[model samples]
Target: MPRQRKRACQDTPEPETEAPAGKLVKANKAEIPAEPLGEAKTSDSPEKNRATKESGNETSRYWLMKSEPESRLEKGIDVKFGIEDLKAQPRQTACWDGVRNYQARNFLRTMKLGEKAFFYHSNCKEPGIAGLVKIVKEAYPDHTQFEKDSPHYDPSSKKDNPKWSMENLILS
Candidate 1:
């Protein structure tokens, strides 16, 4: 069974703190609802509209993926990935990789194809949910783990038995 995160109470107010730029943190559990929550986007592209409509499935699970919008140095690698960066990718799809947290990686593994997730912009001056994305592919071995130059490299993770996994997501 997959591990579940602790849910925060809706009645309780959370204290706001000043977080440094490019830091990643778990989102508030209280804000996650059974149904999708966000402003409806109108688009000229039919493909974009289709993805948006297809995401409204009853079985589709929701997740919050915190990505740093501002650039910062981590293990000598510049970490400045954001929602706009995802949109600029080929077919607007990219691998959700470099997750080091054990529990967070497990959560990524549990994400099913077609499921929806909030592209949360964390550790910035105006941090918030930037956009939504749909899981285009299921969990697979994270290629970055095998790259010696990659910041997420894990020397112990052999090709035969990889230690890290990642999912492919498309802009929704």
Candidate 2:
């Protein structure tokens, strides 16, 4: 199993469907219907659209991954994937997985292969863009959500219908 992560908010409305395997999805919607669970689903446009995957050569995209320096920096108690730790990984790569937020999970699901993101260190003594990381692997079910002992564990999540996903990142 993979690392655990916090599950999505129960109030957040679910996506219409999961993105297909080996495909790309663009979150073109102005906003997604997520607030409280009781509210009715709303859309800015009359027509409905689905997340589409790219079939051919696609352009690379950019992203910014923020983290608190103390959480991931070397010798930190939390020891989540930090800048220096990623450098020591085999091939200087590590799994960019274990995110618990629903919205963040959606972004990872729709991400394209080879996309590059700026690793920004947040809430630290010196907070700024630390380095770069490339998406080496596509999103897949994060198995950690089910681990009872893990901080990210979610008993409500199931294997067949995983509530979380993850990807592998290589330092660039």
Candidate 3:
């Protein structure tokens, strides 16, 4: 069993739970492929470990993003979103939103297009890296922060000067 943890959606906290043993489920009741359940494989080679893309003089960096696999409610909104949910999006693309931490938001702002990230399944029974996603778009204003019903919403955030940011990712 994996230890439970609190996920931060801005100031809201959602309890994480273990994912049930079965297929990955989408919001539309469709079944999507899930990562194999077991220990995650790793490589020690610097070449393989460093998944970077060179652009001009800058190199894209790697990142690990954690999401809950099971359903969890926060502020009347279900904050349960994971790799499977992402894979179900149109063209396998979705906004990496709901992050409110200032530091984490800053990190999101720094992400470059074409960068790859490990989609880690957090707060689940078999928590581990589920798959990889590519940064298809750079940081932008997170629309979830503007929705009053969203768990990530912030009443104080202004449209002219958004306090939160998000990135667009596609399954890789």
**Residue pairs in candidate 3 whose N, alpha carbon or C atoms collide under 3 angstroms:** 18-125
How big is the positional error of residue 23 in model 3, measured in Å on the Cα after superposition? 14
Off by over 4 Å in 3: 1-56
The segments of candidate 2 whose C-alpha lies over 4 angstroms from its true place after superposition are: 1-57, 72-79
lDDT per residue for candidate 3 within 79-107, as digits (tens), equals 77787676655556667788988877877
Segments of candidate 1 deviating more than 4 angstroms: 1-58
TM-score of each: 0.66, 0.62, 0.68
Going through the candidates in the order shown, the clash numbers are 0, 2, 1
Error of 1 at 171 (Å): 0.6
On lDDT, the candidate that comes out on top is 1
Top of the candidates by TM-score: 3
Candidate 1: tens digits of C-alpha lDDT, residues 1-172: 2221111111222213321222233445344432344334455675444334444633445787878888777666676788767665555566788888887888888887767788888778777777777777788888878878777789999999888888777767
lDDT of each residue in 40-88, candidate 2, tens digit only: 2233453422222254334445676655546442222253545765565
lDDT of 1 at 161: 89
